[model samples]
Target: MAQQRDPRGSRALKELGDRGLYWFDNTLARGAAALVGWLALLCLAVVVPVSTVLVWTDPAVPASAPARLAAVWRLTGETLRLGGKTGPPLRMTMSVLLALVALLYVSLLVGLITTAITDRLTELRRGRSTVLERGHVVVLGWSEQIHTVVAELVAANADRRAVVVVLADRDKTAMEEALATRVGPLGRTRLICRSGPTTDPALLSLTNPATAGAVLVLPHDEPGADAEVVRTLLALRTLLAHREGGREARPCVVAAIRDDRFRLAATLAAGPDGVVLESDTVSARMVVQAAGRPGLSHVHRELLDFAGDEFHVVAEPALAGRTFGEVLLAYATSSVVGLVRGGTPLLAPPPDTAVRADDRILVISRDDDAVRLEDCADAVEVAAMAAGRVVPERAERVLMLGWNRRAPLMIGHLRRSTLPGSAVDVVAAGAVGIDRSDLADGPRSGLLVTVHEGDATRPEALHRLDVGSYDSVIVLGRDPAPGDPAGEPDNDTLVTLLLLRQWEESAGRALPVVAELADDRNRVLAPTGPHADVIAHGKTIGLIMTQICRNRHLTPVFDELLRADGNAVRLRPAADYVRLDQETSFATVVAAARRRGQCAIGYRDHAAVHRGLGHGLRVNPPKTERRTWSALDEVVVIGA
Candidate 1:
């Protein structure tokens, strides 16, 4: 304060310093060449003076200023690698010129080498390099389903070495990390990720789709995902056509579209041989099916996933003339469900149907390696076989909580599957864009639908609806908003499940609940009783896609299995197939089911459920294995 020295002067100096810094930064930003030139000049200015002082300070140095200056030049030249030779002016000039020329050549070579290395590294980091593989699986696009698809592929290939190449419009490292977290160990499968737009044919070629055995076009979980899937399929088709060069054979393409409107477009783009699945329709069908049967979702999950017994088509030339009923008990470890004849799958064919030499028997077994034929017909107990017949279908009431895009389809399927007297009470917070006129005039007229505006997650709303009065409950999750995070849709479903569980606990009776979740991980968080079923829409679609990729013929099989009118999987009373409280081998159960025109694959034991033994379910058990049949036990069978 005492020195109130020129405040304006200080401000001017500060501004001048800032301008100098700005100039220096701008100069350096010009180019690498300019930066190097400045670096060289600055280095020379400091090195020369330091070298001169050292030379003059040395006790043995020449006293003349000219000699000292020459010594300094020699020292500076050597330090800067510009020729340190001390000689006559002409010789010094030649040495410096040669040194400069040599420096220039070395700098140019080093720059070329460095630039080449950098470019190659950048290409690698950017995931632009092409994958060189044969018979590998090429996956186009990325979504939540990618994890399930890749994991199933890995498990399906655990017996042999295989490769799975993924090309998506995402960072390679990020994709790798996400997959690593979702899909644990990859086993014998090798995964390669490339980053680029899947709609670009040039980028699609990075995965070598032509050489791939199968290509999966995954649709993202967002608006217009079906459109994007259609585009990717078109690009892939173009790439494959270019690579085929007039060849008729093409790689198997499996794709899915969320909306039915784009299903035809995706199918056309995928070619006649390709498979296009309507994911929304399938999900809706599964939810309705699960609502009718509590443990049906688990059975479907077991059949779709690769961890347990799955469908396998094997040739049994030795038993070509054998009847379908005899073939049912042919394999002690495998359960024969149907056969593939003339490139078509016939599930639960007539018992009298003869197995042709060209036909492949479709059986559910732990693995293809376990589909060995053994005589188990002798294990059957004729006395334990039930003489019961199929019962008549009855109408029931179903309660639907929450709503989404799949609700209308679910209602449609429900209406078709249920009898005319069946009623469905749909309780949602709002109408959710439903057209009331369409439901009353169309095929949906068979089933009476009542809309109630109430939040299903609230306990008061559920209590008011007389939650325990309904025969079955279907929990449909709401769709996410425009900028919602992944799995956020499942929150409402989980809360409703908890409330339902609380109601069950207070009432001292288990409620039959089937929930549709957006994320598979959220399934674990759901509070479920033995009768509750949680179906993850993404997992179901992913499993179906991977199944088609493994064997394209199974598309029809899945289509029929998910349909209510077709030979669908059902959980019937064990007493329907076997005598209650009687000890009999599973082969006896299988034989009894065969007589009833059904295929018994497994059984759910109510006693085992109380004991927590594999949730009281066993699929593809040995035919020779015997167990006591209780009325509480239900037989898992595929029937019409």
Candidate 2:
């Protein structure tokens, strides 16, 4: 060099510069913060040094070093539009260049800040923020059942302010829009949607499960839904364990599993206080029950749905020590259907059985608050007991249309409900075959199931079956289309129903037809038929899941009711409980049913059944209400 340079000083400076560059690169690679920070640093470093140099070299500049420094600061502020006046105005060429440099720096700063803000907003919309709520209902996962569950919850909490927070792997805006389209007005209930995978512990915590009132885990509509449900339950458990209050603070968790084999594992995963429902078995049992007894699905819909009368467990001390039959008349507005003692529901218990002080009466009413016991002894008019006759079970011919995975289970149920020599003919478009070995037990139980290959939707195929020849015809919902699984199979079901109705009209006879539907909305869309009973599968399961989430104890009660064995809800002949063609009070009807070891909850008028008027199926009628019964009217009862 010109003058011997200090090699050590030069090397030291080089090392320092290398370290600084390394740090800057690492920081820049970190994320949005680093990018913004680096941009800010570069702007300051360039603008300050350049402004100082310009101030010192400019023709209209201060002479003193202190004045020059002050002028540089002023110039920097003015360039950044931060406010300040520097020396005299520069020449035209210099002013233009300075203004362009200032504009460049300002644009860079504005762009960085805007980008940071936009990114933050996007993250928020992605539902990464934690929820700060207590006593809210947390729904984990998204599916068709969500709409029904949310609507039911909204309806249940109509009189009170409630919050339902939805956590699922979906766009927050998309979920909100879908719900808005499907669920209409929510009344006083506030619905909050969050976007994230429900199985993530971090996301689960965002739902505030530890402080939630209840948690409903809906299985996604995909393969291995039960596996996902189990995983979600595990995540919830982990979140609950880490909560500040510990296990005691955990909310009630309820989930629906599709496979019965996985039910035990899911139940254990849900803890002692949780509930896991086997949805497939429940739906299969429902199909069988509905096929055996027309209008039974409607009865279940009423009891399970929040829009109508539902089951409530209320402790009525006023009825303590009184016989169940006597207590039945104690509620003018509510109907006492069962007794729960020691956490066991005794539906249709003995008439003379005493109601203990601690017994909780299972009452059916429009709402829990509406369930009231009054002194209605004078209001109840007990009619004179008339001759009652039990309808004997007989072998009958049944027709089944379409097929799905539920067919085998439904056939087993049919065998249990029907008599020996009962025949069931299954007709479908495809040549789907059922293993005789799988249905061997059905024939031994007196029900024979045969599968026929034919398109049931076609008139020729339906005509060949002689629809009027069967006692009851079941049109099971077909497998969903590959392209559109959410689409309802009701089109085929509706066509089959119309054909059956036409056949009945031509033959001058009515055939009881129980049609399985994929969507509840389709029930209204399909033409109403006198003999048709539509069972909306998704809606039914959703209703059951919602009911269990509200009260877990009902799980066992519903299980016992839907099982093939033990006592079940049946629509027996009205003559079996009371004399037909004679005006009788429901009080006498209740007593008559009790005499026959059954409980009469309601009755379906024959006219209603023949005309497909569901309103005629009255449940929990007033004890004082009197009506003349027809021979064809069926008494809705809980019996073995």
Candidate 3:
């Protein structure tokens, strides 16, 4: 008996193991094959014109010429003729042959160009994609935020080659225009763009997530940004649930969902690997902190931006068995403020904490600090030198000029800080849907949660909110209710900002203002005078999303940065450190930061500030300008 052979079992079992990878391999192979085949075909076609000219122009033997002519005679070389005399048969034949050859050549040229452009156009029409490469980040969205995220990623990845890919609904040209205008000036960064809404199932495949190290999903302008995030979560889950074998899916996906409700939904839909960034929550928190502390935003700028103490997880192998406090006192030239075990991070936990082998140390210093730790120091002395070890004496009264769902969260965080004992008010036309009862008690045993209802766009209404009473005013643009028209919230936010500036002008006072803006286009209208701060909320969210997607473990690092007392975002004058006498080097910037007892990371050139582009400030200029940083320029940081 011929032992019956089982058929169709090999591929079936293999397919069950890793269907996506198999498909990805096949697709790539097929595309490569098709591309090569097309090139070969085009190369072959080139011979047609050359052969035609040779057969007609070269007086080959009469017999050979006629034979070749006969072979090519099937098609007539004719078109709408201009008034002219017809040449002799041989001359006419040669003319016709030349015309046919020229037409073929032209058609080939157009076809090649048209196809290349059309292929790009097709990708641009859809908005999400993943680069199939390790240690490379996949940013899924298109907007002004892309500029900042790309710039920072370039700086963070300066030590290592990094690739940042963008996926958005805009055409390739649109994405290219955004990159050129907003992010191209940043350091050496490789960018790839694809088209497709990140929420779509079919479109997501274009990102090639299986091999990506991280993925960043941006906050959308739609009222339902959260809902869309949920959809994206579902899509990601579907892709992940197929149970692919062999290759572990390590790509970390971080998406920004503006609403708390949607953020919860996204977590449920996606897993721990899927991070949902609540923009309102973070913005409000940052604004509140900055309001309480004059330069805290500057500190945050350094932490989050590539220009300063960017947060990173450094392995403290020597201190792995030691307590966090002991490590903090003994470790190198950075601060060990927090820990992340199995991807969950504790921001600024107690110092006398045990360190585990798997824990990722959250440190704040220059980029190199993450790569190496030099020594340990006294916790108290370190505290006085760094920041936040002691609370400040100043009491800040913060006024929120605009309202969004995140207002309450921001206010709550402010109360937790030194600002809780004082007044905190939220002024807005629409109702902020949040339960005030959930907030913590204050020095008076009850936190101050004041709501001043008014039209922020009206100068008089804005004046009524008493912007001058507070040290800083956080202006949050209204969020679109799920499914509202696009750009409406941005327009409203812009109008409200204009009204506030008008009030400031009328009153002749400039109070500190940290505003959450919906559109990057309105940056030109942004107030840049002292105490005026405009934040592209979406762009900020996008940068954070891009980073967490790039390095999932860094979330804890950012959490610590935003949590610390001396925590402030800063952009130091670029010229302070880099000496023109020194040879070109970004390391010089780092050295100067160390001297100032601060961390120098990256630089923001003059162009960004020229037009009040705000968040458009590109960090990490290429090594070309590494030799020296100018005073007109600034390095971002988070310190006193």
Candidate 4:
């Protein structure tokens, strides 16, 4: 039961509460009372001594003063009756009281001032304190992509101080709040946010581009990100070129390339090491490559992502002044993946080659490249080269069986590999638009873009292109409209391949049929067997997205990976099978590619028992390379 309270106590509490005093609550009231008492005492220290001095010093300090003094003396005498003090304690007592008041006043003043100064100073320190270190990476721009970029930078900079400074025109506080809410928390990395235009160098200075280890100029949200990256690069270049602003000498700069033409421009402006990420071009290439080589996108992902091991530009002192193939064997135990010698990449050299000084030796290894190599079994690569069969280069007429979304990209990649004046006939069922206005138009001239209208799936229409005249036919997936819920581009490609197989059979020889399959389930429809290569679009998209999530920095890695030449990724026939050794080292393959100016990071062997498992192939081999390899090994290398 609730007890009745006392009225006097409730009234006292109400009075205290009305004055913002809650003495009814014991702990709170004690604290408040103590504060007020101290303040009142401090006031007394000022007021009492000054009042006494005014009375004591005045000439007219008067008869009233004498009367007040007499009254005090009378009171003192009454106290003397109670034995308080002798002779009214006049001279000694007054002197002690005045001295005590002065001491108390000085003490209170000093304490209050010290507390105020210290509190303010500490607040200032806590508010604006942050540190950015050397070799730290900076990302400029905010998108759904920035989240992926941030997570990757944290992993990459794990061994060191990996700072990812974000500079966007958005609210700095909001960005930081969003990051904290999304990623939960990150370590080592200090996420600094700066507000301003990304194209502005002064805002970029917050990233300390000059002192920064590297800068990644991300594409903005608008269609103009490519242009912004270019402009940002120009700003970065201006920063790098200038001697002012303590810009830390401009570490390395990387950017995303939206257009092919701009990629070249960015490369020139940013410097030799600068990387240009061509998003759409690469995404399109992955789809095309996956169309031809199933699960290759996964191989690209593991190599490019920061979570796993990959290629790096390491210095090969022994390879300096040595032949390319000779250098490969010299470091046989260690793979001399490629030569970044004087910025001239002589990757995967042929046997009996030479290496020079000032070459940044590009090699592939497991982990983030912290491992040290004592020796490389590169010498055996030359001997193996002597035994392995050379991939015969055949010059033949190639006809395009069908054309669709990846048609232009296939034509572009083909331009790099195709002979001068090679005929390419586009067999499309609908009106094949070959306008120069489209961004898909190939930069090279003289490549024919003839569009023949007919049902490509029908055997008669397939014959119209004279499929036998061409040695290779690449069938592209059709474009699907947004409203069409049941469109099947890969199904159409498979049908075209089915029709083309008849022509090849009629000619009494097998022509390479490279077709794009949107669904991996339709992969088995190609009757040309191994003679025809099927590319799956879904797998490539998944791998690209997965790899980006793993390490968004890999955009450049894929960019270089899809390029036809100049330090690019390539698939080559392996020297030997893996039947003899259960332990096949990546260094053995790396050793092989080095001999041929190639970087062998991974492989795909048809003879492997579990060939289709884990995206077919992802080989990050053991550190040592003493084991023998079997004939089933397929060497995967990268280099010009």
Candidate 5:
């Protein structure tokens, strides 16, 4: 009796309702056919009742039940767009069949359109579409240097409507977002990202490298990055060979490899037009150079980046037969550094060498605009020019704060450049591995080597070394452990810098320090005195690679400029080139340097060194700009 009561019956009906809903949901999940059937039944169940109510409620409807039922059937059929015939059954069946066929046709057309659009959009999202731009810059891979390269390229093309196409094995949207964040606004240049393995010939051709003005192959920041770069270069060569114009269609190629062993292989793969640089060697050389000269990196920053004065190659047909010494004073605004003859850069060549008819002179200028070729010879003040005096070399001392695989290379470079009796004290946690016999074995017996076992990151270790006695200090980041894939060596480097800064403060004087950083972004976090320089290895290489891509003739120019044994850019006392404490024009300085067999390009004001204005470094200043020469000012010149 209790089970038959209202409460019991209501509970039983609720359970049945829940079970029915569950079954319906399961059927809907089965497939689209089941879903369509359920949808049709649901429309019928609702529309038929509503149609029946309307027919019954209307006063003009027939009193007969069959007539009313017929009216409801017509109403429901019309509402559902099936059919609305009222006379013969066969005619009604034909109308319904025609309506069903028409509905099916519309549905099929809509589905086809949607499917086609979706497929096209998917293809675009996958970044497989071929770029149609001509004379564009094509970047073949992604790396830590991508941001710096792209930013510099954009700055270089600021006056023109240019495009940079990046082809890498990364998501297109992600690459775009990352660059937008890191590289900031690209101004007039447009950046296009494509996703694919850069080593695949088919995918590489999608970038349209044949029509590109230049192609830059960036190495990945990993153990086998050089290998990947080599393979990509090979694939690129293969693709270009099969293209319409074959090798003639290939653009100028520039690539960088981290390991020296892979440089020759990469160079061979890149062919005759490609320029390959060993990044580690270049960076080690730069660090050594910076350690020797405190403000040299700032000068290089001005030279390498596009935002400042940079190397430009221009032709001067009228001055072809003039001696390079006469050509030096040809332009008042631009500074001539070398001449490119037969595609070779002769930097700081003998002043008496005649400029060939086919030669193009390399100048450091603010832009690639046309040169007016005004003579600045009249502006030269011979009275203010100082007589040249040869400075004698002296033995020095150096302190190295850390160690890595590149340490040996740095030591070797220092040995080549340092004077005899110079000593290098290396303070780190491991044995320096460099032997005294190695230094003695060299042709020039320079750089007495000493290694102390201590953690450079520890303050006690830094304090024991007296921290500031050496002429200059070099801080290198700890090398990544072997086989440790996710190691971050910059953390240790930062700690060492922090402690070094503290020690420098305690010593009560400035230290000419040069620190090596792995990541460019961490350069801001480095702690040092006003005289310190932080060299990000990847950024230095990237800037040089971009510069090479812009002009292939600059390969030998940089080779001669950065190495220790050749003519290099140097900062000497202004008194050596001009009369100090007196107002003089840059032409007088240029004339003074010419007398000493050097090229005067710019100057640095020591008074403005720590004022946050590029360390007071100026490159390629106009010859007409006259200023009072202070005793502390330095003349930037290129010489042996």
Candidate 6:
């Protein structure tokens, strides 16, 4: 029948079908498409062969081959549908059993698919997604300074839409929680947090450094933080090199190096346009400067904070060709402190120095938009007060309490600033030692140094030192004991401050005391007396880092101001610059300082200092305004 039709070809066709099935089963077990593949295999393996066997064994089944195939198809479909009214009773019973098995297999497949989806979601939350934002500020690494930096950036861009993305080798949820607690609300700034190793190039890309407006590298407080910062810079450089347009199209980078030794290396890694700050040297110098002037810490804080008056650079064509002295009185609501020309900052330049057309005036104001010049029609007349005698430099006795890593640097700075015959006495519970050999051959070789071991917080130690005899007292914040929290250092500092205040009260004489603090929050706990000058270490460093990030030109200006051999910030007697108890314009004071080869920026009122208020430290005062001075007042000047 039909020429005994091709038995060999039919057998070959059957064998090909069997081989295809075997291949499909293996592929399903290996590939991601296994779920659908396994489901198909399960239906075919359980229903197709079983349906064929049942129809062939049944005597009532169709006799022809096509009829048998149709019966098999109907049975397989009925099994998947659970049961059918038109099917034979026996066939329907069998369909129910096969349906239960299929249902069990489908449940297993659903469970596996759900687990796969959950794993992907978890990975995404771990900060593996690529960022698509442009012009955002990217902060690399995490440290205590992050809160201050973010807060400052938020305040700086409060009126505009901005984004700040933080990438660190910390838990994403933990970082977000810390930020939420420290920074309560960000008005117009959007904050994003990602968790990854900051030194890894691939991980660094998660913050999209190529498109960022600026990248800030924060140094950890632990040992070897400088190395970590340097590594991060290198990683950023690598990413920049691979960017679409290369280095020129890369974002600006700013980094802080705790150790001065690594500054050059960090700078190289950051490229010529990037900024690398020497944080240790900056903090030491600031502490020394604050120690010399009792109320200087407050002045630094005001200049560094965004909530108060901050430094801003603005171009003013109308001010071009005018003298620095004339431009000082140009702004009604702002104070011109210096001039920025060719990207270099010149603070308190000579009064005769002319402002160029391309120069930008560095002004202290509430905001950049608020820097406006007004007509000087209502300016007060400049009256030359009778000149007073210059005060002679004299040697004095000083007392230092407590000790830390910064003690030696502070001592060296003290030596450089004080007269040769001056003496410094250091007392602390721990071993207080410094290399006095270097001082032996310097100009300050004559300065005396004494070290004593005692608990500074005790009443007996205060009495033994005869605190009132010293011209000034410096209390350095103590390091916390092992296992103690960070705030403990500040707590000890506060206690020492209270004891000093008591000592001054009992001695019935105001003692000039400059107290160093580890945390800014403890500043409020300090006694509200003129004798207590509180300087927060963390706040000072935070402000410096923020300033460098905002403008790199300030680095050299700060270095010069804080260096021992360069121009320094000094509070000399007001009488040395101008006559006392007579109304005189600041312009006359400027002239007097110029005569001495010094630059006068402001003056401090001794009366205000005695009242524990900072209203006395008047910086960038209007040049045409007339004010009376006292013998106790000090003129703020930048001098040799």
List per-prediction Cα lDDT, in the order shown. 0.89, 0.80, 0.61, 0.58, 0.86, 0.77
Root-mean-square deviation (CA) per prediction: 3.0, 11.5, 19.3, 13.7, 3.7, 13.3
Q: Put the candidates in TM-score order, highest first.
A: 1, 5, 2, 6, 3, 4
The parts of candidate 5 lying over 4 Å away from their true place are: 1-25, 53-64, 84-101, 245-249, 387-389, 429-445, 479-489
Please give, for residues 10-29, the per-residue lDDT of candidate 4 as tens digits: 99988877766443344445
In model 2, the worst 10-residue window by lDDT is: 84-93
Q: What lDDT is obtained when candidate 1 is compared to the true structure?
A: 0.89
TM-score of each: 0.92, 0.82, 0.60, 0.55, 0.90, 0.78
**Looking at model 6, which ten-residue stretch has the lowest summed lDDT?**
377-386
Q: Which stretches of candidate 2 lie over 4 Å from their true place?
A: 1-105, 244-249, 375-384, 442-444, 481-485, 606-614
lDDT of 3 at 33: 70
lDDT of 6 by residue, 1-640 (tens): 5567798999999999999999877886787668766777788799999999999999998799877887887787777665432356677668767776777788789999999998888766677677889999899887657888888888877789999999988888888888888887999999998889889999898889888888999887667789999999999999888886564566778888876689999999999889787765666677767654676666676677777777788999988898887776677667666788998888777778999999999777777887778854245333444454666778878888888767777777777777778888888886545444533436435668787898888888877877777888888876545555656777767778889888777878777788877666677788735745787766666676667767767776666766755666777788887777888777777667765656666778878866756547787666676788898888877766
Ten-residue region with minimum lDDT total, candidate 5: 432-441
Q: What is the RMSD, in Å, between candidate 5 and the native fold over all Cα?
A: 3.7
lDDT of 5: 0.86
Q: Which stretches of candidate 6 lie over 4 Å from their true place?
A: 1-113, 244-249, 375-378, 384-388, 432-444, 479-484, 564-640
In model 1, which regions exceed 4 Å deviation? 1-38, 49-65, 87-101, 387-392, 441-445
Winning candidate number (TM-score): 1
Candidate 3 whole-model C-alpha lDDT, 0 to 1: 0.61
lDDT tens digits by residue: candidate 2, 61-166? 8688878887887778776654555545554346556766787798899999999999999988887777788899999998768999999999989899999999
Per-residue lDDT value at 592 in model 5? 86
lDDT minimum window of 10 residues, candidate 1? 437-446
